[model samples]
Target: MNENEKIREEILNTVNGLSDEQLNANPEKGRWSIIQVLDHLYLMERAITKSIADKLKSDERVQAVDKPIELTVNRDVKVEAPSYVVPSDSFQTLDEVKDKLAESRSAFVQLVHNADENDLEQKSFPHPLFKDLSLKQWIPFVGFHEKRHLLQIEELKSKL
Candidate 1:
């Protein structure tokens, strides 16, 4: 397997065995439950697929995304997605989240291998806390972000 595929397999393996409670529990108020996190992550993967496959262009006016565990907690923003921020949602069940994640993760791993180098470098996307970032940076961010959240989930599980 390729490097991207290897990384994907490792990450997906981690996600596969999550218990229902572990997947559905929220770490904090106004925060995403584990299920929500998976859906949101799937949402992000779709956006990335668009970027890489379509050779997308960003309008300067488009908002940015923030960091992992990244909450804007900002009262000022009213946009559908905070400019430069990841969206959080409340998914009803772990099964629902996992279903979507399975699709998104497969597509994402494929995109990483198929991505055009130029598109990866030239495009910029909004981050919630951090400002704009390139596709190259964003790809790795997905892995790092997932791993971080999994760590959070594991910690929460241990406490239970």
Candidate 2:
């Protein structure tokens, strides 16, 4: 399959077997559960859609200081995104979140395929954590972001 298709399949495979408790576990004070992570995925898909569809500036921002430009640069963001993401809403149930995640992920893949040179060339708003993640660079970030959560979910599962 092509690059977008490969990314789509990888996402489809990664999030397949989450449990309710695992989805609900907040991990720490004011953190997201797997369900929230799924929701964030959906939220991200929306952001990508908007960003690509019209070159629309990110109408949204993560919590904390909103260092969106971090996406454009290269920094270790695995810690910062979680640290800054103040949940706008409570975590939904696993079934609900995953269902939407699947759909949104497909949309994300479609968006990636539709991207042009500028989309790939233009960097994400500077993120507080990572830096230099241009649109093209962010492709891996898209997958990596989910994988990071999947690992977190699994680690949380190990304790349970």
Candidate 3:
């Protein structure tokens, strides 16, 4: 969790000082802007946090081996974003996106802090690319997911 928060702070800092126009400008046709990437991160975090909470509450339990989820940071492999986690096309400011990210992170942090470590270790959920990942792994998976997008954000900024 400590590492997760640190990565999140780094992500926020990466966008610091950019004007709203720059943040929201599309680097190229069909490509996401910086704010879009941030919005996607917020949406993904909220969905994952909700899924974790639901999985924790349910009786369904599945055991899975630990996956090399750290590979999530690799940009070589391209994975399409799931429709549910996709960001909206609406323009957004840095502060707006930051608030959304904060809200989602708050829910995620609360869920993990209150959850039983044993339960987190025992249960599992399916990731699009990673297949079934342990609930415990999903915690840091959020950070890795963001780290992946952070690179994208940097790329978008470079183009702008």
For residues 23-46, what per-residue lDDT tens digits would candidate 3 score against the true structure? 999989998889989999989999
Q: Who is ahead in lDDT, 1 or 2?
A: 1
- Which tens-of-lDDT digit does each residue in 35-151 have in candidate 1? 655566577667766655554544333333434423322324332543323645444565676577678778777776776676667666655555676666677766655555555
Tens digit per residue, CA lDDT, model 2, 1-160: 1543454455545556756666577666665565665677677655655555544244442222222432432324445444333344564676676677678767766777776655456435443355434556555656555555556555555544
Q: Give the TM-score of candidate 1.
A: 0.59
lDDT of 2 at 23: 59
Q: Tell me the TM-score of each prediction against the true structure.
A: 0.59, 0.61, 0.98
Sorted by lDDT (best first), the order is 3, 1, 2
